[model samples]
Target: MDFGLTIDQKSFINEIAEFCSAHCKAIDINDLEKRGADPEAIEQKLAAKSWYGLPFPEEYGGSGRGYLSVGLLIERLAMGGYPYPGRLQITMLNGLNVLKNGSHAQKMDLLPKICRGERTMSISVTEPNAGSNIASLQTAATPKDDGWVINGQKLYSSGAVGERNIIMVAARTDFSVKAHKGLTLFLVPSTRPGLKFTRLEAMGRNIGGLYEVFFDDVWVPNENVLGEVNKGWSAMTKGFNVERAIVSAGYLGFSERIFNHTVTIANERYGRNGDSGKRGAVMSRLAEFATELQAAKLLTYQALRLADREKLSIEAVCQCKVYGSELAKRLGDFCAEVAGGIGYRMDSLAQWYYRETRIVTVGGGSSQIMRNVAAAQLGLK
Candidate 1:
């Protein structure tokens, strides 16, 4: 099998890199100090380029690019030290999954807007009580004449604060069945009367607002139910496979960016204490990071390949998510050490990179949970 990208893929990479270079040439130390980008401006900028929907189908007004192209786009954008690309990744890609699984009416209503950047969508899965144990979710959906009344809260919902829609909300439509079996999915409007979004403060990805959302009697119409009642758990699990795959791709890009910066700085930072020995140490550490980054890239690319092949890649997804996220964390730590005192400065992107990488280990699924999945795949307990 060939590992190198084809000419078309190379052209796609070039296009993404050109866009990143044009927009991200001027890095604002002030923005780093502020810890947030102007969301409105960022949205408009990305929308103009159709970056938000690059991975969606053409019918949805997207660029109609595949995941490989999408991954390259995200990597370049994230290397800019702004989380704008991540916000797009969360909103647009997850929204596409909804299009794939949702009713035809649902797709027609939302997909065009999502692709046009007139709207954004986020996934609502993790709740205050159900972080790792997705099947243990307790959000309930009681039947009404025209719809279902939803009541529960979701936590750590990325980009939900100002998003237009979100999918993957699990509600128990049949309590008699097992927890996973009883759950259903819906596309709930974030601006509905019974929905409330609470912003969460965080160390990184500050520009992409994380939120905790409450759904109190949030009425979701029968037309908005994703797939079928009591069958949504499987759909949601499948979506998770997609989510983990792309999220790992984004962080892998970030890891490469941070590692590159650390190497460039280590080679040039002239100091009294920075002897040849220190320089050699930094180079050796960077070599390790490079090796790990290559491992992460291989895993992530393999997962993408599995996804494109329509294979059961749930196990590969877990492995990529776990390994890529951990490698990102390690790269951040090593970068800090290599950069010495300046790395700890709040004004530096290195500090922010470290913070961002820390979130990866916990999000999607914890490293421990990932390991359990990997072990179970191996026929272990």
Candidate 2:
């Protein structure tokens, strides 16, 4: 199958590259390890270009770009050394979720803000006791006279810090049924009286650090419910496919960047060396990484194309996530090895990627979880 990008797609990528050149810089691994990008600044730059609306419908002030386009945009931005703007990533998926599952009023109120980059949102599903086993999440949302009362704790909510104004919370609304069937989704506001957030110290991707959020009898109006009660698992499943695909694309782009950097370093260090053996060895390793990166990119784009056609396949998405994430880690390892002692230093791009690659395997969904998903799709027990 042909994997060439269309002329329009190539042009758009070039535009993004130009934008990155003007507003973004090569990230400092040490600084990023401590904190994330400034949300306000990132928002301003993105909004100026109307990039915030790339994946949304035109009525929502978006550009009506397809999902594949969004994925390409993300990959290009990440490849340019941008932090990937956690809020933008969350907002893109959250907006799609809201558009698909939210009530009319919800869409009318939030979509415009999302398109304008005036609002930030996050998905809060993982809890202290439940990470990959989402069905086991204990967060509960009980119906009351006025609304639903939510009481539970969420962990590792990446963009749920003060930056996020809206959080799509997953909770158990019914206990009599199976855990997955009894769950519901709610759009809870960060400013709600009973909601609180505490930051979690993490090793990398420090911007909008991981958060531990506590909901103590927080009341959400019935209108805030997303999709049907107890049917949230289906909605979440669709969103997860989208999330994994975008994440995979981002990994592919970042890994390509790392590979390119390594090649430059290898050439600069060993270019004039008389020893053909050492030089050939480094070149071989680089060639292998380049081949893997290309394969991962194709897989990720295939998933995105499936999403565009609304034929999202769990197996394809899982394959992309697992392969792309693992490819990133492998590339990081190879780059670090080539850089030697200098790579271990805090300022080294190789060192930073090595640390950052750890999260791609764990976040969105772990590699183990992806394999299980693929197995299930194949009718394996």
Among these predicted structures, which one has the highest lDDT?
2
Model 2 regions more than 4 Å off? 26-29, 36-39, 274-276
User: Can you tell me which runs of candidate 1 are displaced by over 4 Å?
Assistant: 25-39, 163-168, 270-274
- The numbered model that scores best in TM-score is 2
- Per-candidate TM vs. native? 0.91, 0.94
Write candidate 1's Cα lDDT for 82-160 as tens digits.
4633567877666866767888787887778877888777778888788788788888899898999999988877666
Error of 2 at 86 (Å): 2.5
* Candidate 2 lDDT tens digits, 1-381: 457779999899999899878767743546644664444665678877888889888888889998889999889988876775356777788888999988889998988888887887887999988998899999999989778999999988877755447999999998899889999999988888898888788766666667889999999999999999999999898788987898888898888788889998898777966367888999998888878887898899999999999898998998899999999888888889888899989877778777778788888899998898899889999
* Candidate 2: worst-modelled 10 consecutive residues by lDDT: 26-35
RMSD in angstroms between candidate 1 and the native structure over all alpha carbons? 2.6
